[model samples]
Target chain A: MVAVATPPRGAKRKAKAPTAFGGYWRRNQLKLAPWLFLAPGAFFFALYVVAPILQSFQISLYEWDGLGTREYVGLRNYEELWWDDAFWTALRNNVVWLVLYLLAIPGGLFIALFLNQTVRGIRIYKSLFFFPFVISQVVVGLVFAWFYDPTFGLFNEILGVFGLGPVAVLGDPDYVTYGIIAAGLWPQTAYCMILYLTGLNAVDPEQIEAGRLDGAKGWRMLWYVVLPQLRPATFIAFVVTIIGALRSFDLVSVMTAGGPFGESRVLAYYMFEVALSEYGFRMGYGAAIAVVLFAIMMIYIAFFLTKMYRDEKGV
Target chain B: MPSITKTRLLAFAAATMLAGAAMPAIAQDEPLTGELRIFLDTSNPAPRAAMEGMIARFQEMHPDLDIETTIIDREAYKTQLRNFLSANAPDVATWHAGNRMAPYVEAGLLEDVSDLWDEEVSRDLASTKGSMTIDGKQWGVPYTYYQWGVYYREDLFEQYGIAEPATWDEFKAACQTLLDNDVKCVSIGTKFLWTAAGWFDYVNLRTNGYEFHMDLTAGRVPWTDERVRQTFANWRELIDMGAYIDNHTSYSWQEALPFMVQGDAAMYLMGNFVVAPLREAGLTDDQIGFFQFPSIDADLPMAEEAPTDTFHIPAQAQNKEAARAFLRYVVDAENQSIINAELGQLPVNSQATIEDDEFLNAGFEMLSSAQGLSQFFDRDAPAEMAKAGMEGFQEFMVRPDNLDAILERLERVRQRVY
Candidate 1:
């Protein structure tokens, strides 16, 4: 639609006097307010998170029992990791976890779309779908372990219904990693679904109606209009999914404990096994692994932050 | 000159007051008055109850002293103890006796109990005096020492017409018989991974002798040595014969215990602690039997794994004298007997009378007859070496084809450490 145009040059120009205090307040207050609000949180963040990161990095360079004189080994720990097969296995597992975990975003979005309707007792269905996320990871590990049990597990029972022999989901090296990942995805998918559900509620109805009038329906509608609107939610979902995958420690710790010959070990569990568990007190070596893991996580964090910066600048 | 004279007079008065206070401090060596905090393992109910009783007796004996004991699970105990000792250390905490104490000892975290051990308890437990001694000094006093070996089901053996194996050949034969009968001969859980290393150490000790076992763990002997290969060869034979439980890596020690308890498996090579759970699962004393791991070579010097649990006084202990007194009371025959009765462990003190408990008596008898006592694998070896070594053992057990690769990797780890 076109509107009538007005002449550009001779329209009345209005000039307002600048307030005397405007520059002073703008120069000083603008700078002061953001930092004042950030100070307490930033202090805590520096104390708890940032400081420990630096300390862990420092500790990784030395060989020390939790106590006793720390010997500076320079890069010996990192050097050893170059040939450490277990460390490589752990790193490979983490990559697999990262790649597989991204599936949760789409899976969660699908579930959220399915449950976004305002039917009777939809709230109950939503809560039921969200139930697994509320339970402790420890409990989730135990439940999945039982489910994967070859002898009397529900999974084996289901297999029996098809006249197939029971598969050792947790016991076999070929399947243990997949078994643990499945357990991780249970709650992760639920968490992502909740995020998408909220995002769907905030979707613009007018945009959807316009798309419908334009024959953008089903997959076409989802791809063109709906998903663009869900970008913020998807970004959050992807960020959290990546973090959850990288930090997949608890289920692995409780379920298989990086066993079936340590075939299931991710970096987090392997780091713990090295540092703390009966494995040994190789704190320096463990910290080296932790640093490597932190470096990998930093790449993804930087990418996400850059995207967010661009989006904010556009706003 | 007048200010100097006044300062001299004040110094004289202060010295007089200090001397007065020192006299009372020496005179009232009465029992320490304040709370004595103890951190102990709470996984098992019996020992916690027994400890509470002992604490009550200590409280009654010295009305001025109060004891606050916190019992945590074994895993949590390690984490909490490490944290506590690093920060607000307790007066006395339970710990393992060997290399586990070495780190704390080096850090000056443990109180030097050399004087106490020399004057009081050393005479009572002369046989175990060496166990508590580290370097040139005694760091702590062990209350109980437990032997590790195979515990088998008598009923399963009887059902399969298998006799208790007295030698390596007989052991293999018995394992074959069990396998033929569709029963697994060994039930092992490698989820913790250290349990598998226990078998490795025992096999190595039996195959090569105590000195070589020590040398290998100490990183002196190459892991690919012929003697080490022989141990793996024997282990490979057992695996080939389908002797161990299927999918051991998926199971914890507790989970594998059921196989033995349910008669699905014939034997469990574990520490004496497994007896409590075995008995709890409704297996009678008659249904189970304990044996030293059968000898691989009859001429080898036999070394049984006998890890000891001890309590040490922290250097930061507020009441050092009272802590010493409490340690003394714990090792005394009367208290040792009570502890052993409840704890199902052999007493560290030889003079402490053995009770009627069958398991403890068997453990005591076995320890007494053993040619030598070797600390458990994880305890005897440095922490780094033990982790690599145990993982190697697990890998070898699962896939015999990987033995050479595993041992080579372990050798590389050992070389790097040295």
Candidate 2:
């Protein structure tokens, strides 16, 4: 078979070594192309995300004051966190936030159902409803802060008309966290509504017709057919809402600054306060708090990844 | 071959850039020509204008020196200061006097400026130097400070037939009278958590004196101390009389200004800086009056809250010579006065003449008449203790029954922090 390696000798050809880099690359380009494209993103993710997460873990073991020398104190920072009242309060608030934040899903669905009908100027109404999401959480926080103001706020004015109360939502420790979480829910619900609306648009008409034929008209039709088809949207809504609740910082920070006695603090805000606030640079302690938050988040992230993995495998 | 040459050229460029780096000791003796970055809080319009004037003047005086500045809001500055001070620091930066500068000094983040305190600075403003001193070494230069006291509506007080009360009981009676007359006696905003501390500072200073106030803030005394509890007890009287505006915790000190002006609340305890804001809010000079916080104990000497704004050179700063020169030039009596005139605040320099305004005059008179000056509670206490103390103060204001729990928590923080 030595007729110029079974090729037409009319071509200008030279024998190339199989071990050459270019030869190997050319041979394996299809298999390596995806990985090559992914390299840049992986590098940046490692640098900004993975590296900092590890660095925080390492720093959590130290007693550093940012500007001064760092002393390795092992798990002392974490140990201190165990007895820290603020830590417990922040953890409790975060749990409350997570539990209450799920309300956005149902809230969004309720709103979507009401707003889904075709009516005159309904697009304008939908836009107005979606307005909170378009604006930033910072602005929303400020708005809600004014709304919840005890004396001069619109909320108090409303109460005054009813001869009810001038309740200080942020001032009372009992109501501060709830007040802030409600502010957060305003935008989050709008986000969930959008997701569900998109999901509702893609719902199969044939299934709806079939359900309608089987005496499923209202709630029965939605649960039997419509809801099953909207699983993807519900999943997305749940994941984002959970994450939004866990990292609920901007609204709490803008609204309360974890004040009226740190009653409204989440772990994120508490971490920032301990490390970088006017309170001395306890970088180590702050890092420890960050590590705890990361650990808590990791559980959910792992759950999410496994769910995605299994779902993909099923498909 | 070209790539090899490029690498060599790159190395050569870096070497030339560091040409002045070999003899670092002798570099300080060279003429000051590099950049002098100043990080300061100039979010307020008046102070920002004043700083721009100062920066322009400095640049005019020294054409050879280059200056850069990073401006930030005051509230954000508290956190941003620590972030930048440790790395890529500016040559000179703004900071508070007293215990606010303690942590930075302890960490060796701020440079020692004792050499700048010559005979002239020593003879006239030694007290300021003492406040910025840690372990007998000056760490910063105080350029401005202002008095804090009760700013009341003169017309409202007159209507209520209330005089400026000088004793504790008289103050309580006045508060009761104001309440009975349907006027809120005191308006405070604890949203930022520092306004309540101003009240705490005044009460503690009046009841226990400056020495005890300083000792308490410096963590020499426990929050469980009888005298400390006594300070809170005196504060409780105002609370008992329903003195403060209802729901004060939801407003900032600025947001609380309306209650004072609209006659809903009669008096406001604040620094002299707010006079400009107050005027902007439509309260004229004749309508407003300043009075010292009433004395709680006859034996205790009067001490006023006067939180000073100071400047310091960061220890890690690159341009030391220019920074030292800038601090020296900025704190000259004339410069301090010029900045203060624009800022509507009193200059730290005793020789600097403050502007002729009703509140300014009253503040100067009040400060001069005082036996001692405190840098306010938050400034005098370390950040951790200050935060806990202020939060406790806010709690006590909101729920006076939580006094025991708040004090116990503060004591734990004091023990741990110190």
Candidate 3:
């Protein structure tokens, strides 16, 4: 619209200097305004996010010990990662986390439905369900570590009532990853429950009533009417849960530190272990792991964005 | 390297001239006039106080020198060292001995301090010189070291009619007796993994002797070597007997103390540091006792594990003269005695007097008479190899059947690491 109203460039320059510049500004302000506002944020975004990402890629191609001179050994870090057993172990654990972490969505919806009713002391119950989410992930990790302790845990006591002997859940490599994930799921489920609870508050009662009249109740009502209305909430929950699963560092760190022979390592924790931990000084190898993790997140986000774009177009 | 050596030579010549000019106060002929920054990781209550006190005393001697000190949490300091050493270097920094200092030396982050190790200092601190030396030059000065051996429940051993084992067969026999009576022979926590390496170090040092053990840690010997397997085979006997407490991997070294304190386990193979905690937990001096790790081979001379803590000056430091004085003051026998008395540890200087604590005396005696002293596994080996080796040790303790696989995995890591 502004371009059509603007005079040709040479004709504008021939006018009075002050008026000509003012005229140019007036003509292009609409197009320039949004970009002008976005410049600061975009500059910082490039500096902090994009620049580091590119640097990580460059660093992954060299061999650096964080203290010594960087020797360029192109693709060697990545090549070593191919045969690295610890890398594979971490990758496998990440997949397990991703798959199991999604269970929180349904787990949350069920809890939300159970607590959605209006009853005396219902707020108390809702607050209690939300308590785990409010606490720090570090606290959650500590609580769960004690809960799964081999000698004196409540879990073992509960098992002892059934005459089963104690089991060292954290010490056993076969159960270490699962043990940490279950600890992770405690807070994640609470977080999702809060999301669903808010989504439930916004749910339209009229549509629910209409569905009931059409013989849709229980699971049917939820699937066809209630869930469709909660799509936005569900979408947010899915995105956060996936990210939480992928970025599962604190729980594994606080609970296990990728112990029992690195059986419980997620890629995030493994990268930290390889790059910065007391024994870890391999900066290039750590960068390679970071690059791989970044690639994974990029592919997932790209696919998600494309679907979201198409969905918006359809809408 | 040449520039550093030339600087050292110049400083030494200047010191000699100053000493000749003023014979009365030779050490202080050149009055120090600069800022000296020291970063310490003695964040624990006792050690922190000890270090602060030591620095304060040093500050008193040179009132004109501006001394700044920073104390970081012990674990956090391990990772922060590289950042500070390269970016914002202090004049003096605390670090470990042996291969733990290798990376810094190799990267030229640490200054060469061999000139400070004069004839008297060398003779007094001879035991730790091997640990502090990388290549032919010394990079740091050891202030303190402590022995690693079996700290056991004396009452429990006496109650079970068991004597302190002096030989391998007697050790097994005692473990068997303890096991028969439903007591775990040893209480070890391998959760952090390095505790497992402690066991590995003692066993390897005992079975194959010090040279082979050092070779193995240096990655000169393959993990799959027969001597290495022999060490593991000796360790397996204890493992097969269920000598160590069950589920050891679930607890940290501190967490394993309850077994010995409560008389559930007979022994704990740990450092001299364990004695302090055991006493604090209400175990009497009579109840807790120290013993050398029993001899595994009659023919091999005994070696001991004694990890030393040392201080180094950064190569990039601005105040080398003041820093050298601080290090020299640090290793003075009297300073070592004063600090180690408060530290409940052994002084690195032979002339220093030890506290009259029973366990400390025992450790001092054992370490003094030892043919060789090894810095514990994590300190001796490269960090990557130490990590992989310790993880394998923990795995082996839990599942002895996995020994072959663990050894092969360690071999792969060693090949890559070296």
**Best-fitting candidate, scored by DockQ:** 2
lDDT of 2 at A198: 86
* Candidates in descending lDDT order: 3, 2, 1
lDDT of 2 by residue, B243-296 (tens): 999888888888898999889988898888878788888988778888878888
Candidate 3 per-residue C-alpha lDDT over A136-156 given as tens digits, one digit per residue, 9 for 90 to 100: 999999998899898899888
Model 1: per-residue lDDT, tens digit, A1-315? 234465345333311325667556656997888999999999999999999899889989999766667899999999988998988888998998999888899999999999999899999999999999999999999999999887779999999999996887888878888889999899999999999999998999999999999989899999999999999899899999999999999999889878877789999998888787654577898899999999999999999899999989999
Evaluation by TM-score, superior candidate among 1 and 3: 3
lDDT, model 3, position A140: 93
lDDT (Cα, tens digit) per residue for candidate 1, span B284-378: 99998988899989998578899888889988765566677788888888888888777777787777877787777777777778777888888
Minimal lDDT window, size 10, model 2 chain B: B1-10
What's the distance in Å from true for residue B137, model 1?
1.0
Each model's total of backbone clashes: 0, 0, 0
- In order, the first chain's TM-score in every candidate is 0.90, 0.95, 0.93
The segments of candidate 2 whose C-alpha lies over 4 angstroms from its true place after superposition are A1-15, A20-34, A118-125, B1-36, B56-70, B316-320, B354-357
lDDT of 2 by residue, A1-315 (tens): 586577656333334444577678878999999999999999999999999999999999999878778999999898889988889999999999999999999999889878988999989999888999999999999999989888778988999999988899988889999999889999999999999988889999888888888888788777888899999999999999999999999998899999878999999999988887777478999999999999999999999999999999999
Docking class of 1: acceptable
